[model samples]
Target: MIRALVLALCGLATAATAQDTAEAALRAVQQLEAASISLQEAGSGRDRISALTETVQAYEAGMAAMRDGLRRAAIRERTLTRDLNTQSDEVAQLLGVLQRMGQAPTPLLLLHPSGPTGTARSGMMLADVTPGLQAKVDVLRAQLEEVAILRQLQGDALATLEQGLAGAQEARTALSEAVSDRTDLPRRFSDDPVKTALLLASTETLAAFASSLAEIEAETGAPPAPDATALKGQLALPVDGTVLRGFGDADAAGIERPGIVIATAPRALVTAPAAATIRYSGPLLDYGNVLILEPAQDVLWVLAGLAQVFGEIGQVLPEGAPVGLMGGDLSDAQAILTESRQGAASTRPESLYLEVRDGQGAVDPATWFAYD
Candidate 1:
C-alpha cells in the first residue's frame, strides 16, 4: 500500500507538469493561427509588410514555445516509462491482492480465524485500506491517460510546426517584395554617386569614411537633419538579439573596435531604431552590406553585416521601419525541433556590427541605445 501510494503521488505530479506544458504549446499554436489569418487578410503594399512582419514574429515565438513544450513532454514520457517498467512487479502484486479480496466468498471474507471480534476488526481494516487502494488505482489510470494524450499531442504538433515554418517563409518573401515596391517614403536628398565614389576610394578606415560623409554633396533644397536630442538613450535596438561584444571589447584576436556586436537569429528582421535619413546603403569595403543613418547633424549610426538592405540612399525612414535582414539561411521546422530536443543553446548565430559616430569620432553605442 505504501509503495502504491508513492507511485500514485509521483505519477500525479508528472502528469500535472506535462499537462501544463502541453497547454502552453496549445496556446502558442493558437497565437500562430491568428497571426496567419492576419497575414492572409492584410492589404497590399505597406500594410502587407506590417502584417507579414507580425506573422513572422508570431511564428518565431510559437516555434520556440512548441520546442520547449515538446522537449518537456519527451522527458516526462521517458521518466514515466522507466518508473512503470521498474515498478511492474509491485503493481502486479497490488492488482492481485485487490482481485483476490474482491473474488473471495462472503462467508470466507467474514470468517476470521480469531472469531467474531477479529472479524469485526478485520472489516474495519479493510474499510480503511480499500479507499487508499482505490485512490492509487485512480491515479494510475490518470497517469496512463496523460501519457496517451501527450503522445497524441506530440504527433499532431509536428504538422502545425511545419505549417508555421512555411507561413513564416511566405511572409518574409512578401515583406521583401513589399519593401522593394514601396515608393512613398519622403527623401531628404538625392545621393551624389560621383562624390560618394571619390570619398570611398580615399578613405582607409570606417572612421575616415564616416568623417568624410559631409563631403558628399546633397541635392538642392535638402531638408535639415531631424532633431534627435530628445530621443537620446531611449532608442530601441535595430534587431532582436543579445549583445555579443560591448563597445571597445576585444575579440579573440585581441583587436578592439569602437562598436558593439549583436548576436541574432538567422534572417532576423532589422528595423530603424529612430527616424533617420539614410546617408549610405550598400556594401562598403570588407564590412559586407552596410547602412549609415543620420538622425541629427554630426551624428551617424553605422550598421553592417546584413544579407540585404532596404530603402534608397537619402530616404528618411520612420522609427521601426524595416532596414534589412541578417545573413544566414532560416532553419526548417525539423532542424529546429531536433536541436531543441537535444537541449541546444540559442539558435541565434548571426552577428550585426553597430557603431555610433558623434562629431569627428566614434562614441560608445550604449550611450544612445537602450539595449538592457
Candidate 2:
C-alpha cells in the first residue's frame, strides 16, 4: 500500500514538471510572434531587414523549444504509465481496503474485534494505513490539477503556433515587396563592351581599378550622372548592421585599406544605397564576392565580402536595390583549403566590406552613409 501511494505521488510530480516545460515553450512561441509583428511595423528599411533576420533566428529557436517540450511530456507520460503498471497489484489491495472501510459502519471499523490482538490490533492496523490512504487521495487531487493545466497549455501552444505561421507568411510578402521596389533606375553610364573587357582584364588593385574606370568614362563621354554628394548624411547603409572596423583601420598586415567592415546577421540582405550602375560583380581577391557601383560620374562604391552577388555588370539599380546576400558557411573550395592548412573554420558573424573612392582618394564612408 505504501509503495503504491509513493508511485502515485511520483507520477503526479513528473506530470506537473511536463506541464511546466510546455508553459515555457509556449512563452517562447509567443515572444517570436511579437517580434514578427514588430518587423512588419518597423519604420526604417534597415530596421526592417535587421528585424527580419532576427525573426528567422527566433523562429528556429522557438521550434526547437516546442519540440523539446513535447518530447519531455511524452517521456513523463511513459514514466507514469510504467509506475502504474508496476504498482497494479498494490493499487488493487489499496482499493479493496478502502471499499471495506467505507462499507463498514464507523463503530465497527474502529471497535470490532477482528484481528489477532482483537480490538487493539484492529485499531493499530487502521491507523497505519490511514496516513498512506490520505496521501494517495492528495496525490490523486494533484494529478487532476496537473492534467487540467497541461490541457490548457497544449491548447494555447497550438493557437500560438498557427498564428506564428501566418505571421511568417506575411513577413515573406513584405520582404518580396521591399526587394521589388528598387530594381529599375537610370544608368550613370552606358556600358561599352570593349572598355568593360579591358577594365576587367587589367585592374590588379582597387586604386588602379577606379582610375581605369574613370579613364574609360572620359573616353566614352559618359554623361553627367545624378549627384550622389547630395545624399551625404542622408544615405542609409547598404546592409543592416553595425560597423566592426572603420575606415583607415590597420589590419594584421598593417595595410590601412579604405573601407568599413559591417557585422550583420548570417545571410543578411545587402542593398544599394543609391541609384548606380553595376561596374563589376564577381569574386575579387580576399574579399570573396564583390559589387562595384558607379553612382556618380567620378565616384565608385566598392561593396565586397558577399556570399553571392546578384544581377550583372551594366545593370542599373535604384536606391535600396537588393544586391546580394552575406555568406553563412564556407564553400567546398574554401573548406578544402582550410583542411589542407589544418585550420578550424571561421565562426565570425557575416560581414560586408565597403569602400567609397573618387578622383581624389578614399574618404570616410561615415561622412556619407547614415550610420548609427
Candidate 3:
C-alpha cells in the first residue's frame, strides 16, 4: 500500500509535467516567425500596415508565453530541489540498508535470531519493503530528470526571448512607418485648426469639450454615419489589458472620472473597438494622446494615455484597425528572464483610459464593451 501511494504520487507529478508550457512558448515563437515572413512579403500602405500589425501581435504573444514558461520552470525547479533536500537523509539510510543486504551471503541473509519461523516472517517483510524502496528510487530519479530539464529550458529560453524582442521592435518600427505613409483612408471632415485651438484653450473639462466637438468640424461632404447599435454590449476593448479602475471609481486623490482605466503591458497594441470615424486625434487638456471616435451619430468612444497615435483626424477606420501603442520602455531579454525567474508580474505599468459618451452624457463603458 505504501508503494502504491508513492507510485500514484509519481504518476501525478509526471502527468503534471507532461503539460509542457515550454512547448507552448516554442509554438508562439513559430507564429512570430511566420508573421515576420508575412510582413516582408506584404505590399505597400494598408497591406504592409496589416501585416506589421500581425507581426507585432505575434511577438507580444510569444514573449508573454515565454515569460510564463520560464516562471513555471523556475518554480518547479525550486520545488523539486527542496523535496530532494528533505529526502536526502532518508534516501541515504535506505541506500545503506540495501547495500548491506546485497553484500550479505544468501545463507546469512536468510538466517534469523529465532530460526525458521522468524526467517519466514523476515522473507515476507523483505518482499513488502523491496517494492516500496524501488518506488522511492524511481520517484527520486524522475525528479532529478525534471530538474535538469527545467534548467535546460530556462537556459535555452534566452535565445528565444532575444529573437522575440528583436522581432517585436522591428515590427513596431515598420508599423509606425506604414501608418505615417498611409493616406488612402476616407475622410469624414477636416478639423478647423482655429476652432480646435480656441476650444482647447477655453474648455475646462472633458465632458464640455466632447459636447462641443461638432462646433469645430469643417465639414467636407461627410458620408452617412454607420449604425453601430447592433454592436452595443459586443464591442471588444480597444486594447488588451485588465481594467484597473471602473467608471466613476475614486482614485487615491479622491477624484472620480467617468472612464475606465486599463492596465496594459508596455507598447501593447491598441486597436479600434468598432468601425468609426475619427473626430479628434491629438493631445487633450490633461490626457496624453487622446483619440475620440464617432461610431454612431451622437455617440463617441474616447481612448487616451497612448505613447503614439495612428491615423489622422476625420478619417474612417474599420473595426480592429491599429490606433496606437501604450507607453513604457520595453524590457530586454535578460531583464525579462530575471523577472520571470523571480515570479514577478509582467510590467503592465501603462494605463489606457476609456470613456463612452452618448449624446451629451458620459456612460459606463462596461455597458458597451464586453470586458468579461
Clashes of each: 0, 0, 0
Q: What is candidate 2's lDDT per residue for 1-372, written digit by digit as tens?
A: 112212222333345474554454455555556666777788875556546545544443443344344344444444555566787787788888889878989876656555546888767877897898989867755655555654444433444444434444454446545544534444445656686667767768877877776665432444445467788778888886678888999877887889998886555667788878787778765677889888876788899998867666766665666677777742232232233223222234788999988775888888778786
After superposition, the stretches of candidate 3 with alpha carbons farther than 4 Å from their true spots are 1-44, 105-107, 216-220
Highest TM-score, which number?
3
Give per-model TM-scores.
0.80, 0.48, 0.89
- The residue-level lDDT of candidate 3 at 122 comes to 95
Model 1: worst 10 consecutive residues (lDDT sum): 1-10
Return whichever of 1 and 2 wins on TM-score. 1
Sliding window of 10 residues with minimal summed lDDT for model 2: 1-10
Ranking by lDDT: 3, 1, 2
What's the distance in Å from true for residue 207, model 1?
Answer: 2.0
Root-mean-square deviation (CA) per prediction: 7.3, 13.1, 6.5
lDDT scores of the candidates, listed in order: 0.76, 0.62, 0.79
